[model samples]
Target: MLDSLSLDEFGLWAWWIIAAVLGILELIVPGIFFIWLAAAAAVVALVAMAVDIPLTLQVALFAVLSVIAVWTSRRYFARHEVPSDHPLLNQRARTYVGRNYTLELAIRNGRGKIRIGDTLWLVEGPDLPAGATVHVTGVDDDVLKVEAVH
Candidate 1:
């Protein structure tokens, strides 16, 4: 069936197919990329369909388009940040700040552990025995900084 189309038609179809594949990949492995490549491929396909161009030029055009699309989108997104309901969604440790929890282990030598759900988080604070209540002050790296409740 593909043999029925001439070389130019085949190239156009190929570019459109590449564009579709890149678009699908953008959905699967999303990182605000791949979509630009897909757009570039679609643009190349459109250009090829309108005018006869060498394969080298088609590829070069796609490359330039992809770069420009990605750069422009990145700059636009950087200037206009997206608002999220949970800003600390990715920073779970920081979310613990201002929360109170009972120390699971004694803060001997300024180190101890606190249990949150099924995870035991390492905490740093003054000496406190197990079962002492502490308030989360901040997060330093992976360790949660805490202080005695009273």
Candidate 2:
């Protein structure tokens, strides 16, 4: 084991700090991904002291471990799981675009209502008569931003 407060101490501390920062960033980004790499860093720190591995090797090992963790996590998520908790996690924002919906009411300021896929959504676009059909061009926060369909 290395002395508790030697040069190795700096390397171990650096790894932990970096991991913690990345783990926090993962929260903002969401994905449960970077936490694994952070775990890998903590493991490297332990292994570094166990074997007295040098600094360059420590960094190289960290890089390799982080990459492996990310790749493995991505593959596991890609092939075997559906997140049950995050409803918008399906990346459904773009799916609404180009869909045509009938206007349920008229709006005076680029806001209205429409139904797409059995779900009535608050809509925004040029004011239209009731029963007018509009094409969705985009979305903003669950609301369909639309224009006249024809």
Candidate 3:
């Protein structure tokens, strides 16, 4: 039975390979799904090499460790995550702060036209030049409100 499998060639090696693949995939996908599984697989491989554990035991260990790592990360996010108080995080999800915008229409009173990102927005603030840098403040409905930065 053992003759059929070589060292680090059985599921132990599979675990390590799967773990590495998952870890790399985690970077591309970036939602923290396979990262834990990868870690668990690595541990399983280490244990299999050091203790000569059976393939079945190695697989079981991988499953348990994967669950533990993923669940532990979920718990951390649930416990430590806090909702942002900024109105824009929900209200104006498309707007970004510190972004430079150009005023397309000068403000006569408190109304002006500015281009933010790829979309043009109607802003309300002090009178600004037609091509002045503006920072997005907040949004109402689909219209973005901005203020002249300089």
Clashes of each: 0, 0, 0
Give the winner by lDDT.
Answer: 1
**What residue pairs clash in candidate 3, if any at all?**
none
Please report the candidate that would top TM-score against the real structure. Answer: 1
User: CA lDDT, every prediction?
Assistant: 0.94, 0.78, 0.75
Compose the digit string of candidate 1's lDDT tens values, residues 7-124: 3566679899999999999999958899999999999999999998898899899999999999999999999999989899889999899999999999999999999999999999
CA RMSD, predictions in order: 2.9, 8.3, 7.0
Writing each residue's lDDT as its tens digit, candidate 2 over 1-150 gives 554555455665777776788778878887787798887888787887688778888878888988898889889988998867765567676677887778877755878777666776788889888799888898787777888877
Clashing pairs in 2: none
On residues 1-150, what C-alpha lDDT tens digit does candidate 3 reach at each position? 777865356444676777788889989995768888888888887887789777777778888898899899999988997677774566453555446678888976888887656766777778887988788777666656677785
Per-residue lDDT, model 2, residue 60, is 88
What TM-score would each prediction reach against the true structure? 0.82, 0.51, 0.51
What TM-score would you give candidate 3 relative to the actual structure?
Answer: 0.51
Q: Stretches of candidate 1 above 4 Å error?
A: 1-9
Q: Which candidate model has the greater TM-score, 1 or 2?
A: 1
What is the lDDT, from 0 to 100, of the residue 144 in candidate 1?
A: 100
By TM-score, how accurate is candidate 1? 0.82
